[model samples]
Target: MFHSIYIAGAEAHSGKSIIVLGMMEMLKAMTPKVGFFRPVVKQEDGSDPLIHLISNRYQLPFQADELYGCTLETTRKMIGEGKIDEWVKLILAKYRHIQEQCDIVVCAGTDFAGANTGLEVDLNARLANHFGCLYMPVIKGHDRSASDIADSVRMLEDHLATHQHCEILAAFINRVPNNQTDNLKALLEGSPFPFYILPERQALGRTTIGEIARELDLKTIYGTRQSLTHEVASYKVAAMQVQDFLEHLENCSLVITPGDRSDIILGCIAAESSDTYPRIAGIILSGDQEPAPQIQKLLKGVKPMRLPILHSPHDTFTTALKVNNVEGRILPSDERKIAVALGMMESYVDMQQLRGLIASDHAKRVTPLMFEYELIQRAKKQIKHIVLPEGEDERILRAAEILSLRQVVKLSILGEEEKVRSKASHLGLKLRDIQIINPRTSELRKEFAEVYTELRSHKCMTLKAACDIMTDVSYFGTMMVHLGYADGMVSGAINTTQHTIRPAFEIIKTKPNCNLVSSVFFMCLEDKVLVYGDCAVNPNPNAEQLADIAVTSSDTARMFGVEPRTALLSYSSGSSGKGTDVEKVREATKLSQSRRPELKIDGPIQYDAAVDPEVGRSKMPNSAVAGQATVLVFPDLNTGNNTYKAVQRSANAVAVGPVLQGLNKPVNDLSRGCTVADIVNTVVITAIQAQEVKA
Candidate 1:
C-alpha cells in the first residue's frame, strides 16, 4: 500500500477535511498504525483545530504539534527569502520520520483560506510532486452549478497533470446538492479520471451558537456551556409577535431578538421544553440588552433545561445576517457532525475503488531526495567505523559532528588529539562518540609502520622511512583501514587526491579480478540518481580499461540499490558516427557485455539519447539500456569530469562521490573545496561500501 496520500482542494470550503477524515477512518479500519500530516497550516503556532480534532478523535500516536510542518507565516517568509528549497528539505525530513513510524500517512493540503490561495495551491502541487505523492483534488460545489462543478474538476485535473506533473489518483466533487447529484455524475461519467461526488448535507454545514458568539464577539448570557455543541440548522429573526414567531420556529433554529423581548425569549425556552414544539438550538439576545430582573430570575430556574443563551451587540437583523453566512467548522467536541460526515462519505464514496487506488504504485520512480534519505537510512542499519585523516579542518569536524549525532557511522579522526578537540570547540561543534587519535604518539602507529614496511619491502622501503611516512595522517589513516582497524577511510578535504589515494594503492590495493582503481560520482539529479564513472580517476584508458570501468561502475550502482543500466557514452548514438572515441566506447561495450551478460548495457550513445526516452527510441529503438541508463560510463577523465561538474553547477544537482571502485577496502576522496555536507555524504557511502565488503 502507499505510505501516504495527499488530499488537496481547488478552493475554500471544499469539504476536503471530510475526505481526510474519511480516508483516516478507512485506513484505521484496515491498519493499526496510520498517520496524519498537514504540510501547511494557517495558524501561527500550528494550533489548528482540524489537526486537533483528527488527533483527538482517532487517538493518533503523534501530538498535534508533530502533525504539521509549519505555519503559513513561516512558509511565506521562507518563500520571500528564497529559502523554498530549504523549506522543502525540512518538510521531506519530517515526512520521512513519520513514514518510518506509521504504516501510512494521510497528508492534507492547505485550507485555501488566506489571500494567497493561488500560491497555496501551487505550493501544494509542488509538494505532492516532490514527494512523489498520490494527490486527489476536492472540487467545491457549494454555490456552483452542476456544469460548473464539472468544469472545475476538469481544470483542476489538467493543472495537476500538466502544470504540476502530479500523479492524480482521483477527483472528489464535494457539497453538491442532492437534486443535482445525478446530473453531476452524468456530466462527469466520461472523465478520464475517477470521479466521486458527495451531496450537500445541512448537518455538515450547520453553524453552532458558540461559533457565532466567537465570530460576533458575543457574551454567554445563560445556560450550560457544553450545550454550544448543539447545531443551528437555521436562524430566524424574532421581530414578529410571539404567536407568529412560534409558527416560524424550525427544528434546531436559533432565535435572534432583543433581550427585552420577554415574550419571544420565554416562549422559545418554554417551547424547547415542550413536546409540541421543535427543539431550539439557542437564543441570541441582540442589541446588548438584558431581560427584566424578574425574567432573569425566571431564566435562572430554566437554566436546568441545558439550552445555550448568547447575547450579541448587533441588532436582530444584523445578527441573523451574520448567522446566515457563518460557515461551520468541525470542532473537537462536534462528534455528531463528524459521525454524519463519515456516514455521508461511506454512503456516497466507492470504498472499493478508493482502496484500489490506495495500493502502492510499485513502478513509481524514486526521486533524488528520496534516494539521499534511503542512503542515510541504510547506512544507519549497520554502523561501520570510518577514519577521517584531516580532523583539524573545521569542515571535517562539522561533518563528523553530524555523522556522530546521526549515528550513521563510527568515526575515528587521525590528528593531534588536543588540536582536533580545540578546533572542534572553536567551531562550536560537539563531536560526541568520535574517537580522536594522534598518529605519531598512538600505540597503533608502531604496528602500522612495521606492517607497512613489510608490505613495501619489495619496493625497498626501510623501517625508518615507513615509520616516518606513517606519521603522515593519510598513511596512518589508510593503514588503519588496511589492517582492519577501521572499516574504511575518507580524506582529501585538505589534501590532494593523490596524497589520499596513494596509500590505498600501495597498501590496500585493488580487489581480486580488478586491474585498476576507477572512481564514479553518484550524481543526484532532480528525478533520479545516475552514476558517472572515471570522473575523478583514470586520466585516459584504452578499450579494456574502459570496459573495466563500466563493469565496476555498474557493480557500485547495484550495491547502492540502483538498478544498473549501463550507458557507454560517446558523441554518437548506436552506429550513427565514427571516431576514435566512439570506436573505443563500442569496443568497451562489447567487452563488458561478454564479461557480464546479465547487465543491461548499450554503447556509443549520445547523452540526450541515453537519458531522454523519446530521443533514445528515435536513435536506438530496440536497445534495453538506451534511454533509462542509470550508469553512464564516460570515455575519458576529461569528458567525465567536465560533464559531471557542468551538470552539478548548472542543474543544481548534488554530486555525492568521487567514490573509488575496484578496491578491496573502501577508501574515498573529496574535493579540496568540499562542504560539510559533502564530507558527510562521502562518509555515509563509504560506510555502506564497508558493509558490502564485510558481507
Candidate 2:
C-alpha cells in the first residue's frame, strides 16, 4: 500500500542511482505524478554532472545538503556525542515531507559507512519506520569473485535486517560475464535472498577487429569476419626438428613454426590426416622463409580447410609469445564484450526479450477480463486516478508524462510537490495528467487516527509518533484505497513486499474468508504468459500451506485465461520414494481436491511428467494433469527457485515473476534485476487484481 518508495544501496557507486533512475523511467510510463527525491546529501560540489543530470532530467528537488541523512559535522559530532537518533529524526522528517507531496517518491541513499556510522541502527530504524521504505542493496558490477558478491550481499542483508525489519527485495549482481551467467545464477539459487543476474553494459564492447589486431600486433591478412572476436586460448608450438611434430600438433589451435624448417613437413601430413580437431586460423611461419615443395603441398592441403596462414617473420620466441596474448584483445573491426553486452541489452532486455526469457506454458491463455476490457471499451469509462510510489528518477518521470498525455491512466506520484515538479521540469518532461500528493498531509486526518492507533499500538512510540508513521506512503497507500481515492495502487518499486503490504493489512484488510496471503509471478514470453506461484513468499510450506498455495495459484491461472490443471511437483514421482517430502505433496494434492473439488490437481509428480505429454503418458496412464499442468507448485522455495532459474537459463524459458498473491487489493513488489517488461507485466497483473478487488 506504500505510495512512496525509496531506492537505497549498500554503498555509493554501487549502481544504486542507475537502478533507481531506470525503475523510475519504467514506472512513469504507466502512471503520472511520479516524483523523485534525495532526502540526504553529503558530498556537495554542486557541479557533479550525474547529480546535475538527475536533477534536470528527473526534475528532482533537493538541496545537496539535505539529500544525505547526516552532515559531515553531524557525523563528526555524533562520534563524540553518541546521539544518532537525533540525526535519524532529522532524516525521517525530510522523508515524511517528501512523502506528503507526491503520489510516488524516489528517495536515494547515502553511502554505507558514513551515514550509518553516525547513528547506525538508530538512523536506519527511523528511516524504515518513518517511511516504511523497502531497502534494496545494489552490488557493483566488478570482476569480484562469486563468494565476494555473496559475502557483500550477506553483509548488506544482515545490516538491513537489523535496522529495517524487512525482506531484501532482491540482490542485483550487475556487469557479469556472459559465460559466467549460469554459474552465478546457480550459485545464488540457494541464497536466502533473491538474486538478479544483470549483464555488464554493452557500451564497453566498442573494440573493432583492427583495434584488436593492432593490440595483438597481428596483421589481418584475410577475413572480413574481421569482426570475429579471437578469444585465444594458450598458444602451442610444435618444434619437431621434424620428428617431434606429431606430439606438438597435439593441443594447439594456432600453429607457430620456423619458415625454413622443412623437417616438420611430415608432422604437417600427420596433422592433416587426423580428423580429431577442426583447423581454425592458419599457421604463422616466422623468419619470412618461403616453404619448400613438400611443405608447400602440405600447406595447400590445409588451405582447403579455410585456415588463413600468416607469415609473421618474427623469431620463434616472439611469435609464440605474440599469439599467446590474443585471448581477450578487442579487434578494431570487432565489438568488445562490453559493446556486445550493450547491443544485446538494447534488444535483449527489451520488453520482448524479457517476456520471452520468462515465458512459461500458461502464458498462451487469455484472461476472462478481456471481456471486461471490451465492456469498458463499450461503456467508455475514462481510466483515471492511477497511483505510483516514490523513489522515481528522470526516465520514469518522462514516461509518466507520456502516459498522462496519452490518457493511459490517471497518474499519481507520491512525494514532495515541489521536488516532483522540479524533477519533471529538469527532465523536460510534462506530466500533464499527473497529480502529486504528500501522504503525510492526508494520512494524519482524524478519521484514520483510530485505525492507525490500533495498528501501531504495540510498537514503540505514542499516538503522535504513530500518526506520523501512518502518514508515510506505506500507510497512506492503504488509506487511499480505503477512502476510495485512487482506482488502484502500484507499489513495491522501491519498497519490500512487507513494506508495501503492511499498510494494506493494517487498514485495507483482506477480502472476507481469505487467509494466508501468497504470491505468483506472471512469466511472459514472446506470445505467452506463464504463471509461477509460491516461488516468492512461502519458504518451507507444509501440506496445508501447499494446498492453499496451489488453490490460490490455480485461481490466478484461471484469472489469466489459463485452464488451471495444477501440478504439485517434487523430486520423486508416483510414490517412487517414501519421505515427508513426498507425503507432503500427496497430502496437499488431496487437500486441494477436497477444498476445490473441481480443480484438476495432481501431485508427487516429476517435472517432466507434469509438463511433457510423452513423459506424462509413460509415467502415469490416464492421468488428468499429466503433461498439461499449467500451474506448477513446488515442494519448497529451494526447489522452485533452482528449477525456475535452470529452465530460464538452460532451456531458455522466460520467467516473469514471483508475482505476489493473497492481498486484499492489488499490490506487488519488483526485483532489483527486473526488466521493463517485467514491470509492465506486474503492472498489468496489478491492474487486473485491482479490477477484481473493485468488482
Candidate 3:
C-alpha cells in the first residue's frame, strides 16, 4: 500500500517537476521505489525525465511505453473536438502501471492543458477521478493578488467538486514571500479548503539529521548541522549494478544503498574520494537485512568519516522515494501547524464538553446516570448542604458516608430516616454524618419560610406553591445556589437539559447584562481539544444570536486556559456568495469584533479555511482568521451538528460536547450516550465552573 503522497503544481512552470524531483531525493529513507506517474503531461517533444530518473536511478523495472505513459496533449486534442473514449482508456492504463509497483506515487498534473471547454477534461479533476489518488494542489507562493488566488481556488473547487472523487488530502503553498506570509495566512483562514503553507526551507523532502537531532534532543555522533546546506538530492534507486553506482554517487549527500546488497555498499565507498559530490551524510540502507561483516567494518572506518547508516525494510527504490516525499515528512512548518491543531483541540474540550458529546448515543462506554456524591463537599469557602437526589440509593449513601468522613460537603438526603438507613444497611452502603429530610414530617425552619415567601412574591407564585416547589430537588437545587443554602447544585442524572435548567432559570435567572444563554461542546481528542457551541440550543439562531454565541464561546474558551482565535464558519466566504447562512456567520463575526474589539476573530470561513493554511491562502488571502482559527462558530445548528459529525467520522476527530452554557449556575446536561468517564468529567468541569462562580 502507498504509505505517503506527493502533489505537484498544475503547470510545468507551476514548479511540479522540480518538486517531484526534490521529493524523490529526500524520501530516500522510507523506501526505494517511489512510484512516478504523470497523470497528465502535455509535452509531446520530450520523454519524461521523471521516468528515466525513476528507472535508471532506482533500477525500477519498466516497460518502455509503461514508463513513458500517455502524453496528455494528444488525448486533450482527441477529446476536445474529438472522441474522449480512447483518451480515458489510455489514462486508466497509465494509472494502473504507476499504482502497481510504488509505495508512493508522485502524482503530476498538466499546467492548464485540460482547462478549455473544447476538451472538457480538467487536469486536476481527471487525475483525481481516474487514479483515486489524494489531491494535493500546489500553488505559487508569489506576491499574487488575493483576488487572483481566490479565483484560482474557486476554479479548482468547482472542477474538483464536479469531476474529482477524492479528498484534497493536503495542499502545498510554495515559494511564498517571507515577510508577506503572515498577511497571506490571514487571507487563507477564510477559505473553504484544507492546505498547508510551506515556507522556503533547506530541502523539501529530506531533513537534516542535525535538525532532527536538535528537535528530538537526540545524541547525534555523526553529521554536523553547520556543514550542511539546504539542498538535498533524491535518487530512485540505491544502485543499478555495482558498476553504474559509483558514477551516480557524484555530488550526492548520501549513498542510499540496499541493505542486502554489499556490492552497492562497496561501490559507494570506492567512489567517495571522487570530489564530485558533497561528503555522504551516511548510508540509508534499504531493507532489514544485516550487512556483511567486512562491509560493516569498512563503512565504520572510512577515515574521520561518521557514516551514519539508517534502515527501513522496503526495497531501495521504494524507500528512497518515500524519504523524498516532503509532504509526509514533518518539517518545522508542519510542527507549527500540528501544534496549533493540538492547542485548538485542547481548548475546544472540557469535562462537560465530553459529556455533551457522548450523551446523545446509546452505545455506552460505561453505566448510565452514574454520579458523584459527597457528605461534606466544600462550597463558597464554607461547608453547606450538598443534596443527594437519590438519597435511598446505596451508591449515594456510600458516597455520602465517605464524603462525610472526609468532611468534603454537608450531606442532605431526602427520604424517610428508617428507609434511608435500612437501604444503606442492606446494601452495606455506609452513611455517616448525614442529615435526612422528610417532606411529610420535617419542620419548616423560620428562614426557609421567610426566604420562600420572598422568592414566591418575586416569582408571582402563591406561598403554598412556592413552598411545595421549594421541596422538589430541582427547585431546591436552584434555591441552594440562590439562597446560599449550598455553594452549588448538581442533579441531572435522570433529567433532560431543560429539566435541569428550568428551575435554575426560574429562580436564579442570569446576572445583569447576560443576554442569551448558550452552550459549548468541548470535543476532546487524545492529542487535542475542540470547543463547539450552540449545538444544544438556539437551533437556528439569527446573525445576532450567532454573534452572542461567539462571544460566550470565546469567554468559555478563555476560562479553560485557551487563547481563542475564533472562526465564523459558513458555506461561503465573505459576500462572494449569497445565503442566509453565510450572512449569519459574517454578521456574527462583525458583531463579535465590535463587541470585543481586542479579540482575534474572522468569519464567513469554511472549515478548511479555518484550519488549513494552504486552503486559507488560496481562498481567503486577506483574512486574519483563516488557517489559524482556533475556535469555529458555525452558522447554524444544522451546519454545526453535521459538520462536527462529519469531521468526527471522517477525520477521526472526537466530538465531545454540547456543554450547556448561559445558565445562571453551572448546570449541564448529560447525553443519554454518556460513559462513566464522561459523567465523571462533566462533574469535575461543573465543579470547576461552580468554584469559579463562587469565587
Best by lDDT: 1
The predicted structure with the larger TM-score, 2 or 3, is 2
Q: Which model is ahead, 2 or 3, in terms of lDDT?
A: 2
Which ranges in model 1 have alpha carbons more than 4 Å from their true place? 1-359
Worst lDDT run of 10 residues, candidate 1, spans 360-369
Give the per-residue lDDT digits (tens) of candidate 3, residues 27-47: 332334556666555554434
Cα lDDT listed for each candidate: 0.83, 0.58, 0.56
Off by over 4 Å in 2: 1-385, 394-399, 443-446, 454-462, 651-653
Q: Pick the candidate with the highest TM-score.
A: 1
Q: RMSD, each candidate, Å?
A: 23.1, 28.7, 25.0
Model 1 misses residue 384 by how many Å? 0.4
Worst 10 residues of 3 by lDDT: 367-376
Candidate 2 lDDT tens digits, 499-537: 877777666665665566777755543233456667777
Q: Which portions of model 3 show Cα errors greater than 4 Å?
A: 1-453, 456-459, 641-657
**Tens digit of per-residue lDDT, candidate 1, span 334-402:** 545665676567667776577777865332445554566567657877889999999878788877876
